[model samples]
Target: MATSTQSPLAQHWGYYLNGVEQAFNWPKTFILFYSSSTVQKSLFKSLFLNGVVFFGGLLILETFYNGPEHRILGCSYANITGFPMYIALLGINGKFFTPIAEKAFEKQAKAHPRTTPGSTNIVQSMASMIYTTIFYINCGIFAAVLRSLIPHAGPFLSFFMNCAIMAYYAFEYKWLYMGWTLEHRLTYLEEHWAYFLGFGTPITALTFFLTTLHSGAIFGILYPFYVIMATMATPKPATPYGQPLTSGKGTPTDLSAPNKVPIFFGVRKMNDLVISLAKMMGGVQVDSIVAEKQKMMKMD
Candidate 1:
């Protein structure tokens, strides 16, 4: 009957604080976080490959298709500008570092028997990937449309909006890796929007401003750092508002319960799948499931 008593700041802000600490203690945090040589090797290789691809692809495009004007990075200034790259930027993070993070997470899980199981199976990971890709693509399009609607405002508002979106995208891998459902993820984002925005603001500035100054290489390197930090933060769950996640085997101790609404009329979950199908077949009485649920609740 006891409840979590930790303050909201302590619950959700631990990793964020650790990140700030790590910024000050770069060498120590790097050594501690990447103690394993295998992980270090994998991350280095991924970063190298991604950098080559990103820079090489740009070189090819600039040389062959758009000429010098299309070059964004390693140039004096940007002559080509568009919003499509924003969506591609999200995909790049997932394409390169997600596997490495997953590997590290699996290793962590195996080494610590007490660790609660995360949702890292291929099916779940794939589903999360699909869902996130669709979500970000929609967000990118929405940002582009919004920018068009208010061109007089310049990229100021668009940058802020995109930064918030990208911030969620940054932590999303960790959230899904930790087995958070869509409802839980959305709720956490809503409740801690400011914290998340602050967490992601640096990366947003890098992607938007630094890249404009031909500093994509810097952005490329810093990208993996954020992903690594996010991976480290994944297991430590946070409450919706207050209290850090408990050190046990289950979801975070948020005050809100999972939604109980039926996806369709009279269907709450898999238990009612068959009954709902039966009603669609017209072989069972309609509203029977609801009535039965009401009776069960009354009995309880």
Candidate 2:
């Protein structure tokens, strides 16, 4: 936590700096990632398949086949092959990543032993995981649209949005294991927005200038390290300092404190809209099927 003597601005920026420092604390990341056999295996598979095989193949094609016709072929190859390959890697790597995250969380739990409040039902847990995954993907898409649509400040806004999203992704595995709801995670992130922004900066900066496929490949390679860092990190929220009484009237106020930024507010709204539409469509399909069954019963 930030000291009371520091102004709110200083505390906020202090947390941001702390987050940045934590992100690049690679000695700890290396120790964690290499110490566990499971993490090692996952890193190997992710590095080989996503990094060496997929991205390496593209790099080879681009290098060897640089003609206009070859460019067209490369584009077609990426669309037809690389896209599906990436999706498959995500699914495969998800299985590997989950165990890595669980082990990391369990290791931390042994030392900290804090009670995490969340639903224990397997079905509900699965549903929440699925919902959260969709919400994240939706948030990414919305951020991209914002980047393309708005002018002047669009890129900067999108950049910060991506930073927040990346931070969320890094911490998500830990949060999920702790049984935190999506709402709780988002709220915590917003309240300590600066820290996460800084934490997410390194990853975002590394990938930001690259081409889409290149960025995706780099992100896949680096994400596990960030996940480990997030597990080890202790996020400090910005502290509010008391303001002197104005006009010597009433009580001292905390108006000087930095306000919580609702970073995920837009994404939450978007996710809700999408979920509502999906449910409505599903209900319609069910009703249609029931009506068809009723007609068959009448005929019988």
- Give Cα-based local distance difference scores for all models: 0.50, 0.73
Per-residue lDDT value at 201 in model 2: 93
Q: Which run of 10 residues does model 1 get worst, by summed lDDT?
A: 258-267
TM-score leader? 2
lDDT of 1 at 276: 56
lDDT of 1 by residue, 11-89 (tens): 4455444434432334532753467665576567656644665555555554576745535574322234222343355
Worst 10 residues of 2 by lDDT: 291-300
lDDT accuracy of residue 130 in candidate 1: 37
Residues 70-186, candidate 2, lDDT per residue (tens digit)?
A: 645446555456677777777677766666676667667766778352422223333444555667688888788778999988889899899999999899878766766567778
Residue runs of model 1 more than 4 Å from their true location after superposition: 1-29, 32-34, 56-95, 103-115, 122-131, 151-154, 210-220, 234-300
> Any runs in candidate 2 off by more than 4 Å, and if so which?
1-4, 71-74, 115-130, 242-257, 283-300
